[model samples]
Target: MPTSSPIPANEFERVLDLIELDLDYTAQHESFEDLVKLAARVAGTEISLLNLIDSFTQWTISRHGMDMEQMPREDTVCQFTIMESDFLEVKNLMLDERFREKSYVAGDAALRYYFGVPLKTPNGYSIGALCMLDRVEHTLTPEKVELLKIIADEIVARLIMVQAINNLKYDLNEAKEVKKRVAHDIRGPIGGIIGLAQLISQRGEKNKLDDVLQFIKLIQKSGTSLLELADEILNTDVKSIQAAPELTEHELNLLVFKDKLEKLYLPQAKNKSISFLVNINPENGVVPFPKNKLLQITGNLISNAMKFTPVNGKVTVDLDLELKDNAKNLHIVVRDTGVGLDVPKMEAILNGTAASTDGTSGEQGYGFGLPLVKHLVDGLNGTLTVQSALGQGAIFDIKLPFN
Candidate 1:
């Protein structure tokens, strides 16, 4: 039997690897504000940190009510707290010999009432600590410690999810890069070969023009397939990054949706003889949103509709605003007269594995569109539901609360 190796001495180094591993995930925070806020809230502390211990520094992935991003590890009391492999709540560090002299407790990022919960990775390694601190000492009730532990668990879950998504993204990127390198380099030569073949076939005896056109069409089709592959490969990275900006109130109008979605998928829809239109109820509303995210969600729907609908079929989009007791919500519906899916297929859509059909003109694509759409919608705290009939049409209902 193989013996297990000792755990890495540097937790920060380990977590740095974790962060890197999670960078490609959709849940990977572009910033760690949520974690910081959660830490502070759970511990009821004036300051909190999602701190990772490095070789020489205590790096703060997130800090509530603090400006510092890092501090010397030598000065970090949280470092000592994390090494314990258990939850710690020091009501007053000055009275505690272990941390009283620590500069993090005695000096900067000053600590009085200190609480830290180790953030463990899936393999039972402590990657970091979620710490809450106050400048003044106060007694910590057991309930507070339990709450802090819960928050730490939340942080761990978030980080793990980020890591998982990052892994998927990594695999996707690797596949994409390999495919691109193979296809891009081959496209030029393939095009030249097909072009030359067409020329030779055209110059041959009568009635060979059709054969040449068929060969050229096949080459062009292959080129188009490469283009689609390239788009999916790149979008796997661009679309998957959880870079949605903090929510802000914005004016979302028909024109905005049109300029964003209609302009995006209109050409594709037109090529399929699919008519796309937008209908806005109360055409204008102030709903809090991350504009880029909203755009991404709608783009998925519009594009999906365009891809699935029949030639001359209409894809209708409408936004309805509801204000109840000052709590506002936007109801968005996308109705398409297309080759509507059955119940099992709709469940597949929810599971993010539904296979997509070609557009009216046999437009080809992979099946990632709706999966990404569902993910973006969920990220916005929205609910998405689908209704469809096999031959009649499909309806997508998305309801989102304003930020």
Candidate 2:
């Protein structure tokens, strides 16, 4: 008598994980169910199942006549069937010494026959088996077994193709989301610039030299913003943005930060007739931070301030280095004298539930800016605080550790 050998627990687990079968094991595939039906017909059996063996169980990914979706690994004949590379057929469960004591044989189902072909991947892992079962003793011809093996191959091929299709769809959806975000972020600055340009053109002969200069500066700022927007879009890999590179030494520079901020936001404030101030005090020579992420944070805050603040209102940005607990931390504060937010509104904004509203000048808001800023802030291992009151003003404080 041939004894059935049990697979080692650790190796079984490793193979199961490597197969990645759990992803689709519970999913309904009409084609796969049809395959099970065809398998049962070809083997002249009363029941059929496409079973994937997990660490401790046999999961019926697809089935034709089985009422149960799963069974204990010890109780499943598929377990031993998966051990071999080819088809396994038990002539009669009552006659087979290894399976005669099994519960299914002695229970209500009264199983009497079994035939299964291993579903093997190209990488040589037998993930599971396509099996047929019968309640009466039966025999399978050599030709039938060969046909069963071919069907098993077709089943494996279908599963692989379905998984590939799913992955491709995921990637496409991700790219669309990234494109939508980029368009939304760029729209605000572009719209502001267009509005300012139209205003300049309408003023024509009445436009003063100083006013024209400010408009030009604002337009220049918008163009620079577009460039920065392009940089962010180009550098972004939607699939891997979550694991973006950390702040690196070669990428950090205090001078570039000061220059970019002044160029980007000062004109925006001027166009809005808002008093804009920036103070940078870097005690260290090198400012170690993710430059693009910092730009996104500052750009969103300053843009919001410019949009909300009325004429003659003020916006101030302060950046300094602090020594706390023997570590150098960067401190940033952006305060605005604008129509501030109520507690609920503030909470909603921070929690990404707030709808965007028109600015003081009727400029449209993207509503994603603050949420994106918060995401980037958290990515940098920083903290953000918002302080505001209706009809008063708003302030944003950020703290990031450098060392």
Residues 1-403 of candidate 2 have per-residue lDDT tens digits of 4343456334433343334431433345475877888889999999999987643346676888877566545567887887886778888898888788777887888999899898887767777789999898778888888888989999989888776776666556657657777777889898989999999999999999999999999999998989898887788653223222333322344555666677656666776688988877856434444343565567668777777899999998888766544355777899999999999888886775666676787654445557656766776788888999998989999888754
Model 2 clash pairs are: none
* C-alpha-based local distance difference test score of model 1: 0.64
Report the C-alpha displacement of residue 345, candidate 2, in angstroms.
Answer: 52
lDDT of each: 0.64, 0.72
lDDT, model 1, position 12: 29
RMSD of each: 23.9, 24.0
Off by over 4 Å in 2: 1-5, 8-24, 29-31, 237-403
Task: Tell me the lDDT of model 1 at 259.
Answer: 54
